[model samples]
Target: MWGSDTDVLNLALAATVAATVAAAGWLAVALARARRAHRRSVDERGWLLERERESAARTAVDEERARIARELHDIVSHKVSLMVVQANAAREVLDAMPQEAEKAMAAVESAGRDTMTELRHLLGLLAPAQDGSEPAPEEAAQLTPQPSLSRLSSLIDRFAFAGLPVEVRISGEPRPLPTGIDTTAYRIVQEALNNALKYGGGRPTEVTVRYADHSLRVEVLNSGPSVLRGDAPAPPQPDGERPDGAGRGLLGLRERVAVYGGDLDARRRLGGGYRVRARIPLERA
Candidate 1:
């Protein structure tokens, strides 16, 4: 009886030990499965984040490329348009007025050469530079032009010829400014007048230029009916939509002003018309 009792006790103890081992094995497998699932979730989230960053970078590059394309169109198209108009008008006089035709042809040729040079420059901006290559001196010279404060009058006259009456009112004694400031100011005024001529359609334009202590102010006003004021308001497109090729002119103007740390405001006047105001600090000069 005592021996039978001992054998039964041993069997019972062995069965209990085997049951504990089986439970531990099942628990370990569940834990490993949970860990694998968590790791997979983390990897998926990381992949999504990387994709979002790449998308944003691509969007930025696209916007920059479009802006550059607009600038090239503005500079090249304006010059070519003027040249075409001059050439056509000159052709009308070739038979009737030989001397006038000769003079007109000379002007046309000069404009053509300038247009070609500027177009080359616009294309050069797109080309990839060689590895640390030094630019030829002559090429550098050609790229640089004498853009100074003294060119203000000529710029004004060009707009006046384009049919926008520009009134240049200069205040304070004229002093030499730094090249960067001078060129920026000149371009600001140039773009303002161009906007007036292109959009205003022969309206009276007012240009006020003032130079004070370490500051320059330029204001261009055109009393033309604003697009918003008109009965037909141009419908705004959704994001990523581009305007007609010609409509990017103002966009180009805005970008040009921004490069000099200047602010340009283009909006409709309360009474009637459009106004462009730009303020640039001259201290940098």
Candidate 2:
């Protein structure tokens, strides 16, 4: 009986050991599975983050390209319009008024040169050395300053040379504006005057710049005969669209103004003519 009792106690001890070992093995397998799940979760999160970064980078690049396109359109459209008008005028009076034709040709030359210079500067800004080095001194020197309100007078003169008489009025105290706002303001005037020149039937136009307490307002009013007369030779169209009232120029202008949380109104006046008005809040800018 003593031996049998001893044998039973030994059997119980071995059973307890086996149960403990089985529980430990189960725990080890569960821990390994949890570790693998954690690693997979971490890797998935990392992949999502990387994709987000790439998406943001692509968005930034797209925005920058759009901005460059807008700038190119503004510069080329304004300058080339002036050049075409001058060239046509030159061709018309080439025989009868040789001296006048010479003057018009000179204006054409000047406009062309200005356009080339601006294009070079703009293109230069787009390109950087593949080696990631700074631009050469000569290349840097070729860059020209961007157009701004300070150059409004010259801009108007160019339009005047193209046969669109423009009158400018300034209200309120003139103050220095942020660079972007200044350029935007200048572009607003330019595009408005460009439209007026093309489609205003050579009417007298007015440009008004008002500096309010909190905002800058720009207005361009084409006095009468907003659309080109049927008899008049149609001007060369920009972007293959007839200047018969609407195109990407005004749309681009709206986009530009919207960037600074501004408002732009472009419409035909109730009585006559066309009016383009833009108001940019200085505080938001």
Best by TM-score: 2
Deviating ranges (above 4 Å) for candidate 2? 1-38, 226-245
lDDT of 1 by residue, 1-285 (tens): 999999999999999988888888888898899899999999999999999999999998887797567646656655554565557657888899988777666766866777677667766666736665656788877873644568878767655644468777788667887775676566556655655554565678887777878677778777776555563322334432222212455556566567667776766675556677777666733
lDDT of 2 by residue, 113-169 (tens): 999999988887687777889888887877778889999999999898889999999
Which candidate number maximizes lDDT? 2
**TM-score of candidate 1 against the unseen true structure:** 0.56
Q: Which ten residues in a row have the lowest lDDT in candidate 2?
A: 225-234
